[model samples]
Target chain A: MNKYISIILLLTLLLLPLVIYEDNNSRYEKLSKSLLCPVCQGETLFDSPSEYADDMRSVLKEQIDNGMSDKQIMDYWTARFGERINTNPQNSNYFLILFPIIFGLVFGVLFYKKVSND
Target chain B: MISSIGIILTWFGFLNLILMCFSNKKNLFQTLVRINLFIHFLLFCLLEVGLFLDDFSLYYIANHSASSTPPMYKFASLWGSLDGSILLWNLVLSIYFYVYVKFYRATTELYDIKIFAMIILFFNGFTIFSSSPFSGCIQLASIGCQDFTLLPFQDLVLSEFGRGPNPLLQNHPLMAIHPPILYFGYIGLVLPFVIATSELFNRYKNENWIKIAEKATYFPWVFLTAGISLGAAWSYEVLGWGGYWAWDPVENVSFIPWLLATAFLHSSKTQIKEKTLINWNYVLACLMFLSVIFGTFITRSGVLISVHAFSNGNIGTYLLIGLLIFTFLFMYIGIKNIEYFKTSRKVENIFGRSGFFVANNIILSASALIVLIGTIYPIFYESFFSRQLTVGRSFYDILVGPLLLILLYLMVFSTKIAKVNMNLKKWIIENQNELNISLIISIFLTIYYRASYKFVLTIFGSVLLIIIIGKNVISKYKKTKLQGSYWTGQISHLGIGIFAIGLVLNVTQSFSNELIISTGDTVNFGEKEFIILSPYEEIKEEKNVINLPIKFNDKEKNASLNIFKNSSQQAISSPAVFRNIQSDTYITIKVIDDDKFKLIFRENYGIFILWLGLAISSSSFLTRVRK
Candidate 1:
């Protein structure tokens, strides 16, 4: 009886995301507002309220509606605007270099604790 | 009378302070130090009134004072302007210094005392000489204060009406008091700092300095907490900006010191275990002082533009230079003197109080660092890369969200998990009944808060807060309630918990509507309705402003709003109000119509929680004071 209950709960949890799938267009449309245009100094693509921003938003909407994923759209933007257009720093290079060091320092402490305890 | 006396007393104190510092003979110098403090108090009283009184003979009075200013503002106006404010800041420090001496008269810590005096002198000299409030007024002719060009003395007010303080200040009660309290709190950080620096040169034998500075430290800690909260309260009341802190550069200046002070207080517990986070503690103390200098520079220099009139004059560049040199010197000293504290103390457990404290410091510092960067990032970007940028909610909300989640988790678990040299489950088992009750209630509250967030991550935050409190509530129950320091820490952390809950509610649920409406018109907002009535008006004899009242009808509900304007002008600025709500419905009346009709409506998710948090946090201080 417990196994049945636990499995049922697990299945429900696993299936929740599928049921909650947001429209692709809506998700990307919201995300694009926070991203900056590479050519602009400080203005976000969604912020300009200009012809270019309007055009960009429309293009994004079309692509998203066609079922392109968030990552794919992001990749497309990176190619069009170069990596500079991205609001967050790319998860490569400096961030990549720092990530493992941070992981190591954190894990190193735990690793040392485990070894010492044993 | 007060004007001259303030100067004479300050200099006399300065002379003795110098004597105390240079003359190493312990007996002779200590006497001089005592006299220095006495004179400093007199100076404080003298300048305090000059700013407080409507005495036109005093230049500070002529500038910052107006007879129309209310009594509380009269006290508050003492630190209203640049020179007068520095005087207020230094005087507060002098009082702290004096209080420290009185409290520990029996202790013979000579080097620390001398170093403290030297630091006080430096602060005093900066206030008195460079940008002295005691320094007489400039611009007698300019801006028509005295009509500097022709017969300046004759033009000056003998009892003539002068311009009152900024309207924003006089409008709120918190503004009148919060700044000065914050200033004192900021200045108070210097004492522990100077003592810590002195400790580097001496043997670590004197644990008493921390004890001596304990109450003095808590005194400021309480005030700083009050000051910051009051600042938020003031904003919530007046600034129409619903949020208390905007991550504004100005706000960040005060927050940086607060973070450091909190860290210092937490880590100072290391003294109990024969081990210390000496380097960390020293850095915190020094960093706090650095934060004070940075705030002083930022406010005085007008690097960031705001309504604070204190940020007037050439003080900015000098303050910036002072900040760079001072920070460098302090950091250099800290790094160089690190060898003096080479006692390698192992952190006992990952879940212990000290461990939790270390984590707390990291989170706090990280928050402060982000704020610091975002605050000054624009300037650095402009100077270095010639790229100008504006950091807004996008920068703060997203960046801080993850950290806040982490902090909430830590905060909840910390109290539960961080037992200092005590048996945990054994303690809990004894008080399990109350512990379980508090735990259940906290969990319920967290769930409610998470539901209010409208996001999944809020669940995590809520759980964190519960863990933090549940652990501590159990511990506090086990211990005697009369334990002063122990109780204070627990109560304060409880205040923090309540405050976090409030912050979560406030941000998630606060609802506002911005729209235009004329009088006698009805507008619909969600299921609620607002009937716009007429504008309310009043004029005070002593002031140059007309106050208009707006009648608000929120879904057949009646409310009133007061819109203020400069008397000389036909055009007016934003509206002000004393707001009230029924059943979480926000009813506000703003003037949006040309016939000056009232715009009124109800908003969802009231910020009552914010107020609750502030009240709870501030209550701890009274408890602290009483105990």
Candidate 2:
């Protein structure tokens, strides 16, 4: 009985995070945070205090009101400011995207081979 | 006169270091080394006295001090600028080397000590030649000399009082301790770098190096963690923004070294336990040391403009040359002895403790590598393309955030993996009750907060971790004795769990907005009514300060946010915070005119928990250094 309970709870815990609902306000915030603050060195638009950042925020609001998707808004900024405008790297930067995958595979293979020989 | 004496002592120490390099008498060598270190320490003390006495005749003091500056801030000005900071760095390095030699000179080889001494001597030379703070002013006759004929000192005249330290530095008391603690952490790298380099150079055929390296790395790791936390705390307080970390180049540089050192600590532990990944440990140690140099270069070079970086100068080129020299030296040695890192120990179970450590290192190293590329790529891009690019928090969060989650999961999963051969049913039954209780509590909290499942999961994980570790601690104590290493490791893990929960709460629950209000106007903010009392302005010594009195809904106590315009014509905001057990109402005021003021109110929740966890984690590592 304890084993069955544990298994069910564990499964539910694993799947819990996938089920949370996100609202539009939170979505807007996340989008704003994903873009860089142009005037600041490393700050996001959501956190910057410059008047330019405030203008960007209003533009973001208008785009959202116009029914643009998150990706489309991101595209709009990227087109104007180049790839550096968005804080998130492009999908084309595969070296960064695939680093963990490549490193894990190579490390795992080496470990396995070393252990087998031992 | 004191400044000249300090410089003379430094020169004498350098000479002693050179003589000791060839000296054959062990006791004499030790004596000379001690004198060299003692003289360097004395020089720093004299410099500090100059700051305290408000002796503007010293070139450094004349430049960085003010008659009106408070006594506490006067001492902090010792490291408030470039040359003084270098002097602080020199003092820390000399003190650390002295302590290391005192403790390990008898057991360790003399050759290694000589090499380390050479490095210290090089630092001594650099500081004296390029960045000396002990420069006497001939006009006023301060320190050691009455004339400006000395090599390092020059004739200079100034007004009755000196200019104060940078306003940002003197604004908070945290500045007094932050730079010194960070310098200690940075200088602590000398031990591992020297030990690892010598080990690779001579191919030392003993296991004692592992113990020595681990022992030496422990204090620095704790200090580095503490320094980073203190820096973040300073930012949270001083920087008008609500966030702590901005993924700025300087912040990333500091964080990168900490990550690599953390990886080295884990990998070195694996080498101690299973005799595997020894070479990887060596590689990590060298990389961590190099990262410190790289971080220093980034801050000093002025290649990247950041709030935290020192002003730009030729110091960048010197640091770059130093970094390149050490990089090639370590690489050459690493290449020569790469074969020694390979281990024959085979893991029978992939889910065991050793495997978990391997996974931890991979994630840590990857994260560090990603940040390194992100930080350095911009410099290269600008040089080649004559354009600028930025890698900000958004880039890092997307890449490193998921990796951190995985690391957190492993932190819990590792507890179960140790006894992989145990019966699965028995294991589940043993832990099931506590797990269920934690889960139920998490569910309650999640429902009450109406938070996402991700947040709930974090709570569940944290609760589970605390309970399991608590049980282990109790059981271990109940048994006749407890393992110190196990106790410390578990406590640190518990700290990580707590920190993660705080981070989650901070991310999901924090609220911030701006409100413009006039006198007698009431504004609703975050479930509280803020009633503006009145606006007033006062002029301090060098600035104009504006104060806004505000009262919370039905609360007797009032809070005020102060805004000041300084000599630099820059407006600085000092926020007022209303504290509670679980949250705080932080307000920053910007004065527009006589009546209108803009107030930015940010509610920070669970940050204390994060700070509490940080204290716990750093103290736990400190325990590892003890007998």
Candidate 3:
């Protein structure tokens, strides 16, 4: 029985992410949070209360209804306001993303070897 | 006249620090250090008096304070700006140095004391020469001031009143304590670094230095935890964002030191037990100190775009130079003393307590490293490629999130592991009942909440940790009396568990909506009805407030907008929250016209648990401090 319960739990965990889908409202929230406010320093559109942010939200809603993909919308903003508009670094900067992973892996291996050898 | 006296006292304090660095006589060194501390205390008091007296002769006070400011904010205005914040930093550093000299100096090597004094002297000199809070407009101009005009003394008097503190700062009381507590945490880190460096320079026979370093780390670690949490609380209350952390550059910089120091604390524990990771602890200590300076530089330099950044100044260049010098110095000393710590032992079992600590250190250090890189990568990218970018909340949420989950999972089993034995299979068998119960409950919660896989895993880890810790505490109490350290450690871990659960629930369940409504209008939002009452405006002191009363499901709350009557003309929205144990209903108003208003309503679940967890975790540290 315990083994059966464990298998069921494992299956549930694996299937959960696939079942979770973002609706339009959540998509709007996520997209707004991922974009920086053009007029505010270091604040996202979701957090900024300026008129500019309000206008941006309207534009975002229009784009979402126009069925623009998340990447396309991000690209549109990036092209309009340069790369700084998006809060996340662009996919072109793969080196920036990989640096932390490599750091963690190398450090983890060295630590494991040093500890296990003795 | 008061400004000149303050400057003279600062210079005198600097000179005294210089003399103490070179003094061979212990008595003279102690006396000089104490006098330096006294001078800084006096200087701080003078700044306070100037703020209260509305002394326009002092440029900092004239710029950051006003006659209309409250008494608490008047005191907070000391650290409200760039120059004055550095002065506060110097004062806190002086107090730390004096405490070290009076209590811990006899056991510490003279070289260590001198090195520490020299560091303090450098900062003292930086304040006096580069960023003196006592300087007038002319003196400030002489040091390359660009943010403000260099007005004559008569022009300052013509203004008649100073500009008050930043509107956001004066909006909340947390501003008064957060910076000072964070400064104490930042300055407290210098001692461990000094101790580690001294140990590296002179090979100590006993491991007493490790104990000293560990004990010294506790209060600072506690303070940093409380400070960071309080900062998040301040953001939640004052920023009107309905969220606590935004992964902003300033917030990330402060968090990096806390993460590194936490890593050091964990590793230091294993070092005390197994006499291993000595070199690693030394490196971690040095890195913590470096990160503090780097954080300060990032916060004050304006190299990155942050709402919390000071204006761009020459101080950034000086700080970068200081960072480079110390990096090279620590490298040289670390390499020179590499052979001294070669006799340390290795972990006998990978599943033992020490081994788990190693895992903890690696995970924490990696988290810190990732945060550090993410924070500064934009600057490096911009300078090198001339392309502007930002590393925001998504980056950290993606990279560091799994590491934290893994750390939490490790916490469950690591607590169950015995000191010297490995029997992992046997241990699992013994705790199978607790494990099964935790798994069942987490699965049920996951299904009920319809949470995603990441949150489901987080829930499992948190539940398992709490159950195991609870079981352990119960069994331990049944067997024998638990020690204070043991209880505190378990309580802190339990706090982490609760905090993790609260964070997951908050992220997954929170919802917000915006609506435009007029006074006496009713609105319905997602099964909840809101009745808007009359809107009123009032003037208090220097602020013009517009208050909108609303009844949400039988609870009356007021959401207001405050406009400060000052030169900046800043307007802040004050959010009204209907607090409960389960969730908070928050509302904030933005005036569109005389009749219509835009209100943002946010419902955040389990936020109080986050605060409670933070309080329990941080307050537990108070009892863990060693004499």
Tell me the TM-score of each prediction against the true structure.
0.75, 0.88, 0.94
lDDT of 2 at B187: 74
Q: Which portions of model 3 show Cα errors greater than 4 Å?
A: A1-25, A90-92, B103-108, B138-159, B418-420, B475-482, B625-627
Superposed on all Cα atoms, the candidates' RMSDs to the truth, in angstroms, are 7.5, 4.2, 3.1
What lDDT score belongs to each candidate, Candidate 1 first? Answer: 0.57, 0.71, 0.79
User: What's the candidate order when arranged by decreasing TM-score?
Assistant: 3, 2, 1
> Could you give candidate 3's per-residue lDDT for residues B294-402 as a string of tens digits?
8988878888888788753678888888888778868988888777668677876776777788899889999998998899999898999898898888788878998
Q: What fraction of the reference structure's interface contacts does model 3 contain?
A: 0.47
Number of the candidate with higher TM-score, 2 or 3: 3
Question: What is the per-residue lDDT of model 2 for residues A66-109, given as tens digits with 9 covering 90 to 100?
Answer: 99998899899988988777766635456655764566467656
User: Which residue window of length 10 is worst by lDDT in model 3 chain B?
Assistant: B149-158
Winner by TM-score: 3
lDDT of 2 by residue, B1-627 (tens): 666676777788778778867776666766876787787778778888888887776767776777667778888988998878877777787777777777644343566666677777766776666656776665643322233323544444444666667666767799888888877877787778877877667776555676678778778878888898888888776655567777888888888888888777777876776777767777777888888888888877888867777753568887888889788878888888766755425544544667677778878887887787778877876787776666666557667777887788777766655535434455557778987878777766665556775577678878888778777768777662444666667778888888888877776677776677788888888788878887667766645556667778555332333233323424556666676756778777644545777666778877787877787888786445444
TM-score of chain A of each: 0.52, 0.76, 0.78
- Model 3, A4-106: lDDT tens digits are 6766766766676577633224678889888999888789988886778888988998999999999999999999999888887736667877899999899
Residue B162 alpha-carbon offset, candidate 1, angstroms: 2.6
